[model samples]
Target: MGDIKPLEIADAVLERYRSLEIKEPDSANWTVIAGIVAEDTRSKQLRVVSVASGCKCPGAIVGKEDILKNNADIIKDSHAEVLARRGFIAAILEDKGLLRSDVRFHMFSSSPPCGDASIYEELDGSLRFTGAKLGDWRRESTEQVLGKTRTKPSRSDSIYRSASLSCTDKMIIWSLLGIQGAFIKTKITLSSLIVAAPHPKLIHSLRAALFRGILDRTHTFANEFCIPPPDLSIHVIANHYSGPAHCTKTKPSHLATAWWLSSYSSVERIVAHTGRLLGARSDSTKHSRLSTNALFELSDSQYQTRSEAKINSQYSILRRRLASRLIADFPADHPRKRRLLAHHFANNDIDESVDMRGALPLAKRSKLSPLPAYLLCSLC
Candidate 1:
């Protein structure tokens, strides 16, 4: 394992897959895809299947061109997932001395429509995937409440489930590698978690708890599943746009939420702010290089206020357009849309001086803590 590079492993796995002569089903829907597997120092095996849409092998019923046009979003998301997987694999390889410690790996594009990925060499070379499954809880809850049935789970659902399973799987892999034990032997420095899209209420609560060092105690569904390291200095890079936006478009409210979240002491910085502008349709090489450099440069500094200001300035027009569209499409009585409007307008109104007096007692119980404090305050 120490002698093998992750790219080599990926190539070997893909070659084996090619040799299998697997063909898509007679129907136009089925496909074949790439994947990888590796054994650690202790002979413990870990396999990662690319979430990328299956490649069209010759004789497949469906053509690549048709799939590309119809399922563009799926392909884009799968590619991002594959890139993240590769980065994880590279980190594992480097940890095992298979790759040079100084080698930098690029895992995510600079812009949106594609998910964000950042590999930090300083924080024990840990790789972080931000916004991995954004908007999952909302979508799942909506579907359940509406009693909508579908043949497939939503994209957010798939990403959320996959990230959780990946965490559990990685824990197993790390433990098997002799990394963790009953007592913490070596601190698992590498941390990855899905940051939900910034709803104003959610962002405000997180910011408060993060400032107080009680984020882990808040017990939200996202916090429960995407565990972070205790050190708090491990550099939590917020990976944005990790899932398909078509399922849940990046409204202005979401950007405002992210802007506010960045002000928190816990959130180190954001990656892929305007995801589409950086990577939308073209190759993301330049943007990726620039973003990777930007992340590394900001690793030691405090949160940059100018970066937020720049983001606000750049997206001002787009945000206005999104606001206008929302207002036109959803009247005041529309439950979800109206809430979106409220979030858009309330970004600057978050009361930092608001006391957390009675909140801590109820939050400790977990039952009532899942609701954001902003929402509770609004009710009060």
Candidate 2:
């Protein structure tokens, strides 16, 4: 069989988006979600999904096309960034031999979360497609992309009959099964967390866990590296689950755990991508003051429909700029503040030596700060 084309997956995801009832379905940032889907296809990364940003505007879907068109520039650029970072993440996974090129990640979110089927549903079809491709190719029954199907006599019932085909065939099949195992493992964790408290902080906690997973994949954990301390419980959970191994049994608990870990990774990555885009935009905004009216003009009605709460949530990360400004302007006698600074500096022990001898007050007194003088140095 010929290589499965990227457009096919893009088309499928786009269709799924278009078919949704704008108001009735779950709240998700469909355009951003679709863009991520399309971007992943091009990269040939297993398009594993995690929770998406859910939206709930009454008529948000009506102008989706136009909204997509308007934000296409930023969306495309953001998607590019996500794909780039994913490559770095993928390399980490590859080194550990846990990464499978054919298995994409699928994440689910709910505004709309309760009734959603388990995460296993998304990977099911893709795995089948991978299997079919291998099976046909091995049987030498593959046809031209445009050719009509023809029935052929098969001598062997065993797909494993051919060695060449078997490797790809079994790999795809088993990886998916492995993913199912992972999904189960993830689900269990998520359920327990939900039972405890479905607070917004839960999502943040989940993101940190994902960052840990990425670190693990990069072997950043194997070697001593400055990992932002994650919740001990989450760190324990994430450390134990590296996703599915081929021979792993698909215990119900396993699926729950895998899904939880993978889902957490998806949300974290998407949020990080969004933050990067917003940060880049915020920086540009600093240099050129776009009037609020002018900025409103740039926004689509869809964005306009957003509640102040929603808008604030989206821009919440921007507040770091303010916190950073505060740190830059912090007073000298603030010992507690100084401790906070210390943690930041300590984290950078993973990076290069920070030069603290600059003449600036913040620069000269790095011993009490959390951030490395280098970063604080840049902020100053």
Candidate 3:
């Protein structure tokens, strides 16, 4: 195989996008219903990627070539930014000799939530894809699965349970199984699976859930599909900007959080990648200006001329309180306890020379008190 040109790759992507179809029975009402169902399913998958990858709009998918071409301008700028970051990753992999000339790429657009798009790689006769799911975590609720009445399980749940029987008794079923048919045409073997999120703590929670799903059954999935569990690579992508330097209260970047959480996982690699920086002056609306000015004022008041010791101490106090709350919520032997403790001890050792010279004002401390536990955990 020879090197592929950009146009050729783009054409291939367009072709693949065009070939996707709603695999439902033909009927007048059924057609409409199926289309709606397919679109919703696709939207949820796209949401997973969007939240994880930090891409806002996964772009819209209309099945017409002319429409896609015409609307190409809408996504062109954002796509360029994403492509640049992905291209950098490709370059790094190639430099390390992990990528080869014959490597095939499959791009999925407007499909998954971690972002509006994703890229899959086929190299050395093996296939793999990366996915991300970011944002604040919420506990799954019974109402979400069972509906408002809670009379019975959702229709989707029944369908999924039925589908699991066709695979294997020993293989644990994954929610994503419903969409596996979309990848059938590629016919590539599994090699690696990279999952990313905005924060390392969130990634840790995600990793635990993923492993539970993967390990629930024996090697039923591997045996049935002729593919073993792929090499898992966890990552943190810094797609959002933390505010100015004097903002002692600003949360650490996703990249830094990922680094802190790296030691807890047995992942093959914990990669940190930077995306296009969001410009402060890009939005000129009054609301945007007001918010920016507010942040500046807050940083100036709380951080300017403040001794490092005072800042560290304030942060430590906040972290310890949050950690204590989380520890109380989880069981003594729970895996999350370990992560919380790791965070607590890690921050506890920071230079704590008591300095009351420039401490955060009591009023400001009271204002910060209502910060959500989830956000505080991220700070740790």
Scored by TM-score, the top model is 3
Least accurate 10 contiguous residues by lDDT in model 1: 253-262
**Top candidate when judged by lDDT against the true structure:** 1
**Whole-model alpha-carbon lDDT for candidate 3:** 0.21
TM-score of 3: 0.22
Q: What is the overall TM-score of model 2 with all chains considered together?
A: 0.19
lDDT of candidate 2 vs native? 0.22
Q: How do the residues 92-174 of candidate 1 rate in per-residue lDDT, one tens digit apiece? A: 32233333333222211112111111111123333222232222233432332211111111123221121111111122222
Candidate order by decreasing lDDT: 1, 2, 3
Candidate that beats the other on lDDT, 1 or 3, i.e. the better one:
1
List residue ranges in candidate 2 displaced over 4 A: 15-98, 101-380
TM-score for each of the candidates: 0.21, 0.19, 0.22
Q: What shift in Å separates residue 34 of candidate 1 from its native position after superposition?
A: 4.4
Segments in model 3 whose C-alpha atoms lie over 4 Å from true places? 1-54, 58-203, 210-229, 235-380
How would you encode candidate 2's per-residue C-alpha lDDT over 82-115 as one tens digit per residue?
2222222222222322233333332222111110
